[model samples]
Target: MYVPKNFQEPDRDTLFQFVRDNSFALLVTTGDDGIPVATHLPIELLPGPDGKFQLVGHLAKANPQWKLLGRDTPALAVFSGAHSYISSSWYDHVNVPTWNYLSVHVTGRTNLLTADETLAFLRQQVDKYEVHSKHPVSVESMTEDYVRKEMRGIVAFTMEIDSMQGAAKLSQNRDDKNYQNIIAELRQKDDTDANEIATEMAARRVDNGQ
Candidate 1:
């Protein structure tokens, strides 16, 4: 992530919130052939007391990507938030089309979790995603035997995040007038993704006291 000073997201809380809001992430690791393999999975982001980040997720045991973890291999988890294409028309003809989005890249050491630990991880993920649902589901409701059997089909792992890099490119470099125009154009669109980017840009402006 090549984040310029203006676009750099240095707030730890903000980055964590972004990860939680966009839990579905791309997990990448180098395979034995030295090729990069990626898996899309829903992950749980846990923040440590020391300001480090931890990620937990599971992939199908049959997926060869799981074999890349452990040892000296490094993993990257990429979380992406609302993104949309910005038209040049929104920029007073001075700008070219570009993407407005938010993303966080987490690099860390990967470790496979023990069976017992994996079970706990699955339970926590269930609770996190379902806690706010209108019809919440509990892992405990399932029989212990069934849960164990289900866990066997997947490989659970944890990443002790060594570093996090965040980039929020929302026309921050544009003049206030141009930025306002872009926001107005985005907000008028029917697409939810465009609206989301507009909202983030608005919130970021407010945060910067602009």
Candidate 2:
């Protein structure tokens, strides 16, 4: 996450919102062999000590990646938001093509939770994602015995984020006219991802006081 001053997003609220909106993230760690491993999981971000952040997610007990966390190993959780291809045609002929995106990298020490802690973590995730739904579900509705049994199938852990870096490269370096053209072109596309990126670009313009 080598974010230039212009592209860096240091706002805490902005980074948290990005994580919430794009909750599916890549959890990366180094295996026992010292090889990097990545697992794609839907994560729930929670407040940590000293106004920091923590990431909670579960992986199958069968997933060997979880074994790397017992000793407070370092890990990274990467949350990627909307991104799309930007055509050079949207800019002047001299301009080259590029991709526009928003991403946050959370680096932290990983800790595997105990069985009881893991159950609570899973409950929190269900509450977070389901509370706003039209038909909200509750862990209480499920038999306590059954819930305990189910928790055995997965390993839950929390990453207490030691540092976080966010980058939002949304065509800010482009001239106003070129940026507007890029937004317009993106809006014309049927892909929702392109349209979402365009909206973010427009919002970034306002945030930068451009």
lDDT leader: 1
Candidate 1 lDDT over 70-182, as tens digits, reads 75877999999989999998777665798888899999888899998888877888888788999888778786678999888899988897889999999999988898888
lDDT, residue 105, candidate 2: 95
Model 1, which residues run further than 4 Å from truth? Answer: 47-52
TM for candidate 2 is 0.92
* Stretches > 4 Å off in candidate 2: 48-52, 132-134
Which candidate number would show the highest TM-score if scored against the true structure?
A: 1
Quote each prediction's TM-score: 0.93, 0.92
Give the clash total for candidate 2.
Answer: 0
Look at candidate 2 and give me any clashing residue pairs: none
**lDDT of each structure?**
0.87, 0.86
Error of 1 at 16 (Å): 1.2
